[model samples]
Target chain A: MTTDTTTQGTALADEIREGAGAVVLDQVAKSFRGPTGVKMVVRDLSLSIRPGEFFSLLGPSGCGKTTTLRMIAGLEKVDSGRIFLGGVDATDLPAHARNVNTVFQNYALFPHLSVFDNVAYGLHRQHVPKAELRHRVMEALALVHMDGFAMHRPQQLSGGQQQRIALARSIVTRPSVLLLDEPLAALDLKLRESMQEELKRLQRELQLTFVFVTHDQAEAFAMSDRVAVMEGGNLVQVGSPEELYLRPATRFVTTFVGRANFIPASLVEGFSASSPDEVASRQLSESPDGEESVGAEPSIFVRPERLRLEIGDSSGQIKGPRVRGTVADKTFSGGQTIVRVKINDDVELSVTCDSASNEARDASIGGAAAVTWQPSDATLLDR
Target chain B: MLGRGLRGFVALSYVWFALWFIAPSAIMLIYAFGHTAGLTQKGLVNLNHLGLGNFWQALKYPSGPVLVASLENAVVATALCGVIAYPVAYFIARKLGPRTRAIVLLLVVLPFWTDYLLRMLGWRIFLSPLGLLYNGMQAVGWHVNYLSILDTRGAVMIGLVYNYLPLFILPLAVVLERIDPLLLQAADDLGAKPWTIFRTITFPISMAGVVAGTVLVFVPMLGDYVTPTLMGGARGLMIGSLVASEFTEGQNWSLGAAMAILLVVILVGIVAACWLLATGVRYVLARARERALARVLVTT
Candidate 1:
């Protein structure tokens, strides 16, 4: 596909610019005076979120995901950065002043007020009329499918219900950007899955920008249009869920976002002396008009689902650029079997295969199994 | 169990302990209902019928001065003490961090640990002409009579409130500590302004502590007489003083016993009412939760 120069230019210009529902964070940093010493929690980070886009910050704990979100919400002061909300400079604005709401990890719903009152809180502060406030609150709750629970207090609701109420409270104000800090982390697995669907649907219906923060890669990938993976206070990469999963730009991205089997591979051919970090080059080498550079001695990233496991006499050996391994462990998961095999010397790789086959069920552990994938399936990521 | 020797010994000990505490009150109640001559007979002999005469006499006391005034004054003083203590307790429990909480709590309790009479005397002098307050106020260009507050209802109320404030605050602080901080955060996140948050969430949740603190402060304030006599003079005398006067100065034990019985009944009623209200609130919250669950179940 041809790169749209205008869109790229617009996205670039948006880094320092802000418009309605657009948030720009320019070189933001936050440090805390800890017991040990001054610790840098978030270091010089710059990113722009387009209006009405569901952007996710995916990372482990202490990776500055919450800190960055807090800065945008004006809950935490940025040490140095310019934050703009809806084309207005809001770096110094207090939490109440900024037109942003947050669904905290604990779903900090007011325990005293009913769901209706809680959702009506911000509107009341803005001196919205009673009828309009009621209508807006009801509308927001309806978006989350919680309209029937208007009079219920937060403590009276279940975890999933409380989460929806939290969402309703934030969306009731029609904020330019709704910030969610691991809002579904406290729910049970079943409830969390259901809530994730509800949240996605609510976002679509509301048409508001949502900047979510979570450490769960599956949750981020399943919901977000674009995921910004952060590690150790630095944003490693930002792209669509498919792009991040397929073409991870960094070693951290490959390991953090999904389960990947990294194998040490030698570049037999197609590596140029210049631009040694490009993996796209090798995949497009046969295409005479391709614009990519291959690198030497690259680590090949193979996802679990991409690997095709076969039982044959040619076991413990790779075929067609596929490495061989012995099945050390096999797990029968519902719908899929995860087989762990010794890929290379001192390295173990996990491969997931279809559970519908009786062949996998009959395959015993400690036996040799051949695993192979197409060249396109194996991404040569330069670390 | 009393058939065995060891059991008999334990039973005797328990009976003796119970009698030791209940003996005085039992005797007082018997005499208050009995005629004037019943005290002389002794040994639980010649019990008389119960009559409302003692209560009437107590109410329409010597010189027909309404005895209810002192009781009312005491009740008001106790309520005022609770009002003053709540904010201080809230600050210690919620606002102050660990170290500051300890220091502030100690300061609140320090006054009660000191000599009670001496504290009252200190207040007396403080309200007098040569005290720091009097001198300071005079310097501030206010025309003031330092002795005016002393031997007045205001002075007595102040003394009672000052003495019992910590008793109310300590219990309140303990209950406040149990409340989750997230409850408050939830209120704020729901769009409540600071005042609304405090009124709806903080104030209602802390109601149990308020009742406990009020009973602790008010019950004692009602029975106080020394502070009234020393600081409030004739007008400041509370129900405790009336009870004391009937026995010692007035030589009317029957009337004093009647007044004591009435006070006990009132305190019991107050306690029962508080318990009922608290339980009712809990039941309402639980019912609301059940209804919500039922709705969810039906929808699912």
Candidate 2:
């Protein structure tokens, strides 16, 4: 990672790589004194964001993802645990001193300063020469396509424009880690789509580590190199987007990321079988200690898109896992038909098919049908 | 129909009430400008013939010593109060959270509960030759001059500041309260240091408040009579006391009326200046905003 530091004064870019400027959080916790006294918000959280990596903390509101991001930025004090930025103890450093800048959900731009001055501020603090400061600010603004907006105050900018300015301001400083706290939440649909593309492009162009926080799974999947799904102030799963979707560690992760249909099955001889209630009870009692196992099943999770629809009377004849149901409802979506099927027990499961094939299958509302999927497609989850 | 008629009656009553409030002042304005020999009015609204004689005589009356001293005391006291109250108000408004700020503000205004005369008398007793402070100095083997404060210009200034200090702070706090903490944080995040943040953001935004508080403290202090009479003794005679003397002791009703008009004119000027200052500040801020928008338009 040691580059030509001979010309450039303490080359920040080269130093950022090789895990030299990586941020590591070790066992962080934050608690507030409430009416019930000392309730913890983020409990014993630990994670590492590598240099040049885009990581997302995906969670529902109050899941403490924002708290974790703030702690990394040194904006919030950690109750316990250590934060190391570039292998330096930054747990006690103020936000200004940390080698990180955050784009808040609200954009938090200085209404009094023009976009140029706002972006130039951190450079000015560093005492970068005026000419160089202007050049750098313009360059960063140019990256976000906000170069002409330098003199505009934040209030005058539209929501998407302001968000880009916020990104530009943080990126101009070239901090090792750039944190985005739900930066696109305020944008409308069209703006959010465009900004999403711009944000991904910006991250790649700069090669700066990005730790973005959002509850939108689609957004997390779109931008993150790795996603950490959280629930009740705990990290339920941390993995790549594909890994999370294909094999979710918990039922909560499966449900949070996308829709899932849980069907009761029994693990008989390494194959999950549709078991009756009596055998399920016996298995549940016998496998009490197998609670943490992924295959311990009273319920099996299956994605709607993975289910294969077949004509009626194939329930008992199918070689593998299958369920008999009647078409409860159907929706035409131009490219595909989404059919909601009600099983023998009146449990609903959504299945998707190509519109042409759906018409060929002759499935409609109230039509008896059989939905089949392989055992591998259904991941047994602790329901 | 009945409700509408009742509403009409209420509106009529308000107009009558407003006329009642305006009638006395209207009569006084007519009297002040009229040519009056003691109690006899020579003409109705004939100021051209009267021709500033009343104002000129009032200004020259009693050697003008009281007028000079009072204006001097007020100028000094108001300036001093502005300087002293600004930082205190800024601290309470910006530094403390809601609960602590409420308590601090209460403490600042608590002394106003007592009678104004009692407070002035208390200050007099505290500074008296035989008072506790004087006695304490004597006990410490120090000889302090009692004549300095018993009835002097300094004592009058201090009295004026004490009486009007709260007036300055309340408006100052109001303005400071409206300043967003995020504005300062934004400045800091951009690269401005703590002092720079205050200089560019906090100080300029608070200018309106400073002007407002100055007028609040100064305009009233100019017309104050009790503090000067009680503490200034002989040397502390101000414009207010001169006007008081002309009306009460000298028995020059016309002269007093003229001087009172002068006081009103002075206050109106101060108010007009404040309005202009406020308007100027707002204009500058609006121009800055427009420039910002124009720049954004050019850049975008």
What are the TM-scores, per candidate, against the unseen true structure? 0.80, 0.82
CAPRI category for model 2: acceptable
Q: Candidate 1's residue-wise lDDT over A1-383, tens digit each?
A: 11332232233234312326888999999999988999898888989998888999999999999999989987789999899988789999767677788888988776656787778777887789855665566556666678778777788899888888888788777677889999999999999998889788666655678899999999999999899999889888899999999888888899888889876654545542211223433442332222234435556678989877776455434433444557888899899998887755666778888888854775578777666666667665663
Residue pairs with clashing backbones, model 1: A109-B186, A110-B186, A110-B187
The lDDT for every candidate, in the order shown, is 0.75, 0.76
Instruction: Give a tens-digit lDDT track for model 2, residues B158-184.
Output: 899988888888899989999877666
Give the deviation of candidate 2 from the true structure as CA RMSD: 5.9
Q: What is the interface RMSD of each candidate, in Å?
A: 5.7, 4.5
Q: How do the residues A296-345 of candidate 2 rate in per-residue lDDT, one tens digit apiece?
A: 54576689888888866644444455567788888888888888888856
TM-score of chain A of 2: 0.88
Worst 10 residues of 2 chain B by lDDT: B38-47
